[model samples]
Target: MTTPTAQTASSLRAAGREPPLPFAVTLDDGRELVMLRVLRILPSKRIVGEAETAGSRMLAKLFIAPGSTRHWQRERQGIEALAAAGIPTPALRHAGELHGGGHVLLTDFLADAASLSDHWQAVAGLPASHADALAVLAPAFAMLGRMHAHGLVQDDLHLGNFLVSGGELMVIDGDAVRSLSPGQALQADQAAANFAILAAQLPAGWDEHIAPLIDAWRQDGEGLPTLDTAALRERITHTRDARLKDFLAKTLRDCTLFKAEKTFDRLTIAVRAEADELAEVLADPDAAIAHGSLLKDGGTCTVAKLEHGNRPLVIKRYNLKNTRHALSRAWRPSRAAHSWVEGHRLAFLGIATPAPLAMIEERAGPLRRRAWIINAWCPGEDLATHLAPYVDSGPPPAEAEALRTLFATLYRERISHGDMKATNLLWHDGHVVLIDLDAMQQHRSASSHARAWRRDRARLLRNWPTDSALWRWLDANLPPA
Candidate 1:
């Protein structure tokens, strides 16, 4: 028969083995929680209180539990009562058999996540006479009142404890709820206490904020009292201490009111959107030209020369907004997609581009919604630089031969160089080179076939213009070698 310690070890391994054995575990990134290995410098306000494994949505609570059986029992009893009352609480997914004087519990994951506290913070930052934060506040109060009406006492009530996801609120970590006798006055007292907690943390002039909200909540509530405003205000001031006030103040500064749903797949819709925006910009002759030349040239993008893989490469950075004023507030996946598309085009076209080295996507930087594309450097003089002399010199035989092969290679492959300007072509080491291969498209259909053909024809006209009178001059132009 297996010893109890061996069974426990087997159970822990079955759950999930964390690194560094019996004590240390990884939470996120480099952050680790050392249960028994380290002496306390500062105790974690949040500790891993639960590791419930038997649920569709595995939940682990941090920093909420006081590590007492009483707390655990309170949570378990409250959950059962709330479910009976029809207020949504996480289905007691799984709770450890009471052992070592404590147990852990798990529940279903919440969907459609948005924090009421975050919404309030956004309101605080904006200069406004209009109190718009009530949009979320009224519903929040209604939910709380409904919970209290059902004879559920959430001992630990805070904004974070209530989660709103997918248009539903799921009360979590109920280790502190007290079940009141039906129709008891305890519900009202609990609600008043909870409101006081929220109100104290509210900014100055909160009376104006709460008055309208309470009125709205009262109007919608069933058999609820008309809220006592004066009592509420006094309670807020009396209950909110300096430490709590300081913490709420920090939350206001740190929290974001809204967050976009992030999808982690390699190719995401957000990334595609940015790519489309860039493709449009690159297609614009003026915008492309200006960017090609930097601000002095009035472009929407900037190009710099950089060294990579022992080669001189051109670096392209898109200016999402014309000025910094137009920058986005977060990383734009579209920017990443656009850079990836350009790099892919170059690689497919067999152009001399630096191996795309790395890309830096600034999701939440000053230039939010922006992306950077880096590639191996290609060294050579641009084709336009070499062609400018020949425009007057008349296409030299050697250069003309190289030009024919270059065009032939690209055109035969049914590839369209979106910006086929002469300047983007290069001449290096007696070989024709091409750079700035943005706005590339693969002609996969009949329409694209026609478009690609026309583009190639136009390029020939620009570089080797055959005078209406000079058939041989037209003939002199061949696809670039």
Candidate 2:
């Protein structure tokens, strides 16, 4: 409904025309939308700078169009259905008809305090327990399932539209959401077609997420239309056949079968390949520091002096075989959620982690079939080495200081080092370092809603009970900060 008005002003005789006034832009599609400016900044060399905050300051997204009341009602009802099913779309901020055959709908920007795409790159290479990935990604799949269960169709299935805040993915953009009614198998087919369109837009690797998504859809069934058994099985089969399906198995097998030296060598090759890919994609690829393996040959998965591109970094290839929990998921993190968790922890805690680099699915080959984590390198020394002599005799002053600093660091960020064993800790210069943090507990209040939240909490606590207690005791016994 907002129209452009001319601001008439008498200017110097030869003055040129002024720039166009920023308007509230909204699309017309039988729905009303209002564009709210939450944050505005000048483009640098034509590229928009990323929003560093949770987009508390953001512009409104408007979707407006003219259509019959019945059509609008269907869409509105669909939105309501999704919201009712606990899928957090924007609350209807406002709606109204314009003078012309146009309408507008306004809603809050779906901003994630932590986006999975944003953080997954950082921890992709961390040495995580097998259960860690599942702990993080299962809920995300559940979220997607809830949307589908409620008869809400996600028209756009790209990674960009999905937001991960407080350890959950909330769907936005309702234009493509399809709310189905009973006896509407045909309509459901249409919805599926729309989803197919979106799927075609996704990268090749993302096909693996589909089955879990459909299963989630079924589990979150809220009196909504259901996929037939044959259809469901077909979806599951397709997803199982994706390239990532065997990655976990291969990665675990490699960790067990390969020697430490061989493992490091494989890691190096993967890193080099990743670097080549990054060189093609990154804006300043040269600025990125790539490291292959930190500690190999049965040494602790730790590093000393990351020394990569003058940017302190840590890159860990999680040995998924080491943890008992990994066995449950067949020794692979579900949905790669562990990497995101760890990445967010390092970044939010103001640790010396470089901005996340990239997440490359490292495969040994088509025949051998192996995969592993390859992350940006961090600069530091393994705490095990730093503390070995100390534990043998007396704790070194440097080791104590390192531990103290690490505790303070994680505490400040409210990130718990879930597996804070001596081997996973690191010491560098005068700082305590935390590595292999993909499995750490870093949930927000919102994440507590996941069905698996309580179970995960209990399991996490059970697996690391002594560690948590010891950390608490250590905190109490340590000298005052």
Candidate 3:
């Protein structure tokens, strides 16, 4: 943290700038709030951070945008509503205009608290029906139900908006909390629609396990509004589809999750969290690949293992082969970009894949040439090698269970791995991790997906002989077209 120094809101709002911490912004009351750690920022719009004003720590939200009073007022009103509606929220401690042209809002800070999103990570890999996973989520939905019963709704309902501190599950992000039809419980349709946004946060096909969670909601709900389970399911499917489209669209732009740069001569995008760790490699990928240990250096692609700090990374370069081949692929998105997006998609759906770190495309104007994708190295062996000993018999129970789980998710989401070769499946930590995702596709149409699913199933089974026990086992166990 930097020493406390006064900074102008105008200066900090310049294009893509942020105030250096720990910096002070004078409040309308003439007291200085010194921010020590930045949490999240929307460039020139607003900034959230940890701050102190007079020996007390609080979460400070500086609405530094050109017209921020309206937003600041919404935050204050929302917090007030939460208290009036008997919903738990951090007490509003400070609300005032910035010395310059913005506003400041501060609330009690819970240093030991964790967001539901953070807690959910621990049990997210477990089956959604597992008791532990349900326990973590049940309370969050119960809180939402209580809000609805009290005639309030969290417009942007997600796990992150709930905080667990001192054994209390408290609602947060007052800006998202608002009232509907004052003094009356939310109608069944209104409540279900709001709940759909929250329900869609879980993985697809977990809907069967969701009935129990609604009971948890009913326990806290007032007036006990009847919810149509079928309608809720339909709403969830549509919300999930819309969310997937929005997330994929964000992949090509600069956003919180990704740092992207597009130029006529080049295209570079990296997972924002990995930007500092992989800076050297992202700066000059080809140079790093040249110095790394080569895994495969011919054909349509080249793979290499590189040592970065204490970690190992795998980089794959999609070779141009010839000028003719480059021309054929010029106008379309590069294969590296496709792999990067698909990798994130799989990870988003809770499927296993090597964590994609970054991707770059060498371009001349609008035309693309060679490209490279960087991923965290997986220590597990490929299925072809790992299962070589079990060819005559079925694999171990753990391995079989992992494959079943992976394919179940793929089928539920209508995801098809175009290349289902044994080498593309890696056995990592008792889970099957998919790689070589350049041709992977998640279908939007059921009919098109059925056709693609058939081809994938056949290709996967082709890895073993027709009469082999392992092949027969998979042919029967795996989901069919």
Off by over 4 Å in 2: 1-21, 24-59, 63-77, 98-102, 110-112, 122-130, 165-169, 182-481
- 2 or 3, which is superior by TM-score? 3
* Candidate 3 segments exceeding 4 Å error: 15-17
On lDDT, the leading prediction is 3
In candidate 1, position 315 carries an lDDT of 42
Instruction: Write one digit per residue (lDDT tens) for candidate 2, span 1-481.
Output: 3453221111111122221233322333333222233232211101111111122433232222223344345545656666776777656644444334333344544454555545444433322222443344445555655565544556545444556655556665455566654222224554454344433332222344455445544465454454454554444334433423343333333222111213321322222224444433222222222332335522223222244444444333333354453444443543223553355346533454433443322224321112233345545666555544443344456555455555444443345555545555556545555556555664444343232334433332232234454334454544333
The clash numbers for all candidates, in the given order, read: 30, 30, 0
Q: Candidate 3 lDDT, tens digit per residue, 1-481?
A: 5578787678778735356778898989988899898888888888898999888999999998888988899989889988988888888998999997899999998998899999999888887779999899999989888888888888888899999999999999888877886777899988998999999988875787779889988888878589989888999989978887898888878988888988887888888889878889988888999989999988789999999979999999999888889889899899999999999899878898999999999999888988999999998999989998998998889999998989988988989999999999999987899999999999989998899899999999989888888998898889976
How far off is residue 187 in model 2, in Å? 12
* Candidates sorted by lDDT, best first: 3, 1, 2
TM-score of each: 0.40, 0.34, 0.97
Scored against the true structure, residue 8 in model 3 reaches a CA lDDT of 65
Deviating ranges (above 4 Å) for candidate 1 = 1-55, 61-67, 98-101, 126-131, 184-190, 242-481
Q: Judge candidate 3 against the unseen true structure and give its global Cα lDDT, from 0 to 1.
A: 0.88
How much lDDT does candidate 2 score? 0.41
lDDT of each: 0.49, 0.41, 0.88
